[model samples]
Target: METAIKVENLCKSYGSINAVSNVNISVDRGKVYGLLGANGAGKTTTIECILGTKNFDSGTVLILGMNPQKERKVLFERVGVQFQESHYQEKITVAELCNVTQSLYKNPLDYTELLKQFGLFDKLKSPVNELSGGQKQRMFIVLALIPNPEVVFLDELTTGLDSRARRDVWKCLSNLKAKGLTILLTSHFMDEVEALCDKICILKKGTPIFYGTVGEAISCSPFEKFEDAYLWYTDEEGSENESV
Candidate 1:
């Protein structure tokens, strides 16, 4: 498959602390790539560098063959980002928010259709603050997808959601993948990663402990469940002191 995003020798530091060190990742077009790690494991830092929101100490980063730093304007047009936490005006209605976001992109998706796809069609006029956690997350996803982006970066997409809502979001993401959108996602939930990701990368302390298919990652561990494998790979005693 064609590469959608690539990171080589990616390193970022804060003072003497290395946030990400010699990290490398490749995301293929039309695939969901999961970035899994514990808190403070450098997953967010890695993504910020890839998105050009944060400068790195040294490394090469590419999105669809364009340098994120050099082609930021062009890159922003083709890629969507849903941060781990996002806030909107308390009284802003869902429809109103969509209209504003739609205006920013030249090739925006149909707001009505997108809302329906996310099961937020009936909540179009509801204020953002009034929506449930799951609904808000869905709305945020809709906002990201409104630009009709080729690649999307989602951080903790289903965090704080109940199990039923999380499953619903998973189904929505699976549909997006089926429609050929490349997605890069970060999450603490291993089950979510297993359900949505075609490929997986497990990060520990600014280093990649595993990078390959989800099945391959599972096989590398002694456990049968993906969650168990994840814990083992990130465990201090179990993790090797080497990057993948």
Candidate 2:
């Protein structure tokens, strides 16, 4: 299988505090890789380092066989990232925002079609801040896809959305998956992980407890349910050294 994203011994520190330590990940093309962890497990930090948005203490990161730090311009053209938190101009309309984002790319995707796909077509005239939470999330995703990226990073994609809204986004993502778009996402929701991830890396206290298929992770744990198994990997009393 073709590797899309690879990180070897990725480490990051904030003076005395290590945000991530010896983290390793490898994602195959057209597959979803979930980064599972609690709020302070270094999920976001790891992603930021891999994306070259933040400097890392040590590690090698490659996206589509190109180094993210040294070849950021070329690498980013084929990558899309939707951060956990995003700030947009409050007064920008969906169309206007999409138009602006589209201008940045050499060969942008059809934003109008993307808006339609995400069910934001009717909100073309609606201001970004005026949209509902779910709609806003969908809009962000739409903007990310404007680049026609080969790999997309979604942090907490469905965090605050209602069940139906989350499912809606999942359905849209499933469609993209069908078209062979690779995805890397971080999430606390096991259901989302189950629905999207083909493989995962579970982090605990800035360290990786496990990295492999979901079934492998569960088999390594004492529990059958993914949520229980995830907790098993994160809990201090649980076996953090076990991996598949």
Candidate 3:
């Protein structure tokens, strides 16, 4: 159980509002950590802080035992990131993108095999802008995994795809974790979290309202379903704290 990521009292503010406040999070290696939060709940802000893409106003963030803010280059080598929204040059073929990303890493995985695994083999010669939304999403996912990174970040990964496509992505993600890749994902989809996550951290208004295994979160809440449990927790916080 190596600690792949750690945070203590993490805070980020946007002028008069605190997007993330005194957040403490820790993710062990080789497990899927689902960050469950609604829009504007600071889930993205917290993720950005962890990846060193955004500077926090205060507190500490460590990824792979290195300070993310100060050791970004060192941290990136072992990290794969798939942003919530991703795109590429219109004329760039999928295979070209894969090859370019592969060249950036010292030891990349087999690009062709990865593309095949994600059902993007036929789209290899297709331009990114010409592919269907699902195909494009698969392309981005393949790009992320091609580096054979130790940890991966997937933010709202299944948004535009249909049910089958989303399930395919989930299968790919599951396989990555089986290969001992630590994954941290943020999603508003409770069912997705329940199906894919080993543990979950429920956030409301820039703070952790609950942190535990998926089963634990469900068991501790007085609700019939996970979605109900989430609403119950956040609604309670909203009523009690007002600002939250």
Best by TM-score: 2
TM-score of each: 0.93, 0.94, 0.93
Cα-based RMSD of the predictions, in order?
A: 2.5, 2.6, 2.1
Question: What is candidate 2's lDDT per residue for 117-141, written digit by digit as tens?
Answer: 8888999999999988888888888
Cα miss at 216, model 3 (Å)?
1.8
The order of the candidates by TM-score, greatest first, is 2, 1, 3
Question: Taking the candidates one at a time, how many backbone clashes does each contain?
Answer: 0, 0, 0
Candidate 2, position 125, lDDT: 92
The local distance difference test score of each candidate is: 0.89, 0.90, 0.85
- Candidate 1 C-alpha lDDT tens digits along 1-244: 8999999999999999989998889999999999989999999999999988899999999999999889988887889889888778778999999999999888888999989987899999899889988888888988999999999999888887889878888897788788888999999888888888988888888988789988998899899999898888888865445433
TM-score for candidate 2: 0.94
Clashing pairs in 3: none
- In model 2, the worst 10-residue window by lDDT is 235-244
Point out the higher-scoring one by lDDT: 1 or 3. 1
* Tens digit of per-residue lDDT, candidate 3, span 57-89: 999988889987688777787888888777577
